[model samples]
Target: MVEVTPPEGSQVVIEMWSDLGCPWCYVAKHRLRAAIAQRPDADRFKIVIRSFQLDPRAPRKPEKNEQAFIRAHGGTAAQVFQAERQMQAIAREEGLEFSLDRLHANTFDLHRVVRYANDDGRGFEFFSNVQDGFFAGALNPYVPDALEGVAEAVGLSGHRVREILASNEYADRVRADRAEGLELGATGVPFVVFDRRVAAPGAQKVPGYGRLLEHVAGPVPSERVS
Candidate 1:
């Protein structure tokens, strides 16, 4: 029952539900950004990054690599490996480098920290930084030091971040975000709602996002009839 309102003067408010560890969510974000950039009134759009956990039961420690995680989750070795390769190719198309060797872990704490950042208007930036670091294989976010490094990179207070992680700060917001998304009919990550009017599911292509934006916000002034 959380209320979502567009920022002042914004023509469109884009709320996206995605997990930090989901590869398709990463790609979908990039595509959405690309679509926004292509718009003449790009600055009129406000994006809110909603939280979702692909696996709430995941371990806090990096106990297994991507392959092992997939296999343990019921995917065959051949299917998992092939899917990883395909994902890599798809990610590359979105200007991201993917290395599926990274370890899997629960993202609840990460979501908590990001929710804290949302209060300061740095949530999306912080989330993107962590995802970039994780997917690049440059760091394991499950580790406190690595998580702190990303927070610092995003200009977040290291002490504040540590304190939030030490406690359950923003935990309710994280859970509420996921709950709201589910209520809105999202069954998976990368679910997007434009101006709370058009609901789009999955990691759609760049043009697909553009179309959704246009559908909700309508054509820019230049394209409007006098």
Candidate 2:
């Protein structure tokens, strides 16, 4: 497991287990960040992104369209249509774009790269950029070059990014993260633990996350009267 130490003076450490291919995880990320920004002591919170793969056996390259992929995975055609529409609406509410044309492939490599970024202290930025590119249909991360593009955009070294992708570096860290999440009772993506005490499963609304923060970390201190 990647050992993460909270920043100096950080009061709450939030560990979120999420899969990049999951739209709800993308939306939950935005909601959580929005909630954090609303707090006066936002800087006191530390967020650690954990890796989870919704489809561990998926192919490295996307061979089917989104509809076909969902259907092949046991989702009925009707269910796929309804779920995609609902998720698009929800993503819009969170100020994020969702596309039904997103690539469906194994995220193990992506997780490995994220683990490397986490160790390098650029985890969130790299993860967010990759998610944005993915859901926007602007880039296919399944391609090595596109993945390298995201790493470069996040200020990660090009050579290091290529090296990690070409080898098994950080692969064990990714697996360890997913195992830890399951041990913590995560049955799905977007599972979050606040300070390792409060366990929140699934995608929670912005205000719900706000309440959680307040409950675990206390309310923002009231501004002093002049």
Candidate 3:
């Protein structure tokens, strides 16, 4: 078990690189929540969700079959089914519903929408909406209607969303985030770096994450006893 004492004054910054549609990312979010809940100084943690695209060039609406997508992720049928079960169990733990059957591979538009949502003072709301659409509503967030629906659910004006989606203004921001993710050696979703010392990729479990945070928050005692 890892022992953590929150920084007394300064908040611990956790930069999370996650794709909104990634199931592992979703599970990781819940795991983080659990860690935070256990921490005595949970209130001092600040989490920033950064954008990362699993497929930068995925279609506006995924035209490929789910099996094909799964295979490309190095996912076998057995693994996929196991993930399905795990996801279901995680959703239950998080008190959320996640349906992978209706998921798609397209993420460009969704990322663009997040840009607009960030500008509209609805970043967290928009993020939740997107998460809900994918994990609960069983909606493919890349479609125009689904994207718009999330924006609306987050209280972003329809006009602002339409204008932003029509233009290329936020495209570069999203692109830059993805580029940064790549530069950070993030090859998979839910990559997190705590205090620049511990780097974990792909939805780390609670024990590992908590240990990393604790290590970052303070010095670990030397194992060698004088």
Candidate 4:
């Protein structure tokens, strides 16, 4: 088991567990960002992005569009289409566009990049670019150019990002994040922890999140760890 020390008595920590491929995770992230932006005590709010795998057994390479993937997983056309509509509607609400029919790649490499960004203080910007590239720009996360573009956008070396993806750096960090998600009883992506006192399992409403932030902002959980 991994050991973590929760914040000292009055610190508010937010840990977000998400998959780069999950549309709702993207939406949930924005809602959380909004929640933080509206916080009365923004200085005390800490945000940490954790990792989760929607398909733990996903292939290393992306083979085709998401449509074929759905079928391969035994999803019916009607159901898949409906899900696409739902995703698009929500994306629109969140000021994003969705082309769920486009190619979907394994996010293992991209997530590693984000982990690096976190260490370098560019996590949020890098994470935003990854989602924007995939869900909005229809870019394949596995492609070197797409991944590098995000890196460059966030003031990191694209070449370095490519190097990290080519190697096994940060792989353990990704695994640890996933393990923590399971420990938190997260059955899906977009799992959120507020000061470690409250756990939100999915994409929640914005207004409710704003209120939750205010409530959670008051007291930190006792001896909880990220």
Number of the predicted model whose TM-score against the real structure is largest: 2
* lDDT winner, 1 or 4: 1
lDDT of each: 0.83, 0.83, 0.71, 0.76
lDDT of 1 by residue, 60-121 (tens): 76655654457458867677778889999989877798987878878999999889888887
- In model 1, where do residues sit more than 4 Å from their true spots? 1-11, 223-226
lDDT of 2 at 22: 84
lDDT of predicted model 3: 0.71
**lDDT tens digits, residues 1-226, model 4?**
2234444335567788887778888888888888777754566777778878777667766655555457457777678778788889978978877875566656777778889988887776788777877777567777888878878888988888989978999999998889988887888888887777778888998876776676666432344477
What does candidate 1 score on TM?
Answer: 0.90
Cα RMSD for candidates in order? 3.2, 3.4, 6.3, 5.8
Residue pairs in clash, model 1: none
Better of 2 and 4 by lDDT: 2
Q: Considering summed lDDT, which 10 consecutive residues are worst modelled in model 3?
A: 1-10
Location of the lowest summed lDDT over 10 successive residues in candidate 4: 1-10
TM-score of candidate 4 versus the correct structure, residues matched by position: 0.84
